[model samples]
Target: MSKMLTYDACVERIEQLREKMIVTAAQKGMHDPLVLQYSQELDRAHNYILFLQSLNIDNLSKT
Candidate 1:
């Protein structure tokens, strides 16, 4: 993985991904499996963004 970026940048990127996923889903229809796949991808990205924003500092001490 790459170095951690600023929270703001990660947020911006996550939002852009969300918008793209929404647009693609809307254009492709909700019933499409690909749309669902994109949604799962967005969920994963969202989770990563949340982790970036709210990670516990204490965990960093582990080696």
Candidate 2:
């Protein structure tokens, strides 16, 4: 089975997305539609991080 994503990993992904989006916007202009798409993707990643952090991980121990 695939390993579950941790909150820290999600945060790192969000940071990476932000850096890439900035560089893309710089090259393509701020009004580019791709920038908005990237922003929405980042928001979704952030929400996933929050969801992971809110879970009661202690209850997920292996049998």
Which 10-residue window in model 1 sums to the lowest lDDT?
A: 54-63
**TM-score result, candidate 2:** 0.71
Work out the TM-score per prediction.
0.58, 0.71
lDDT score for residue 31 of model 2: 81
Model 1 lDDT, full chain set = 0.70
Identify the candidate with maximal TM-score.
2
Best by lDDT: 2
**Candidate 2 lDDT score at position 22:** 100
Q: Write the per-residue lDDT of candidate 1 for residues 1-63, one digit (tens) a residue.
A: 155656677677668767877887789877788777767766766777678655655457553
**Candidate no. 1 TM-score:** 0.58
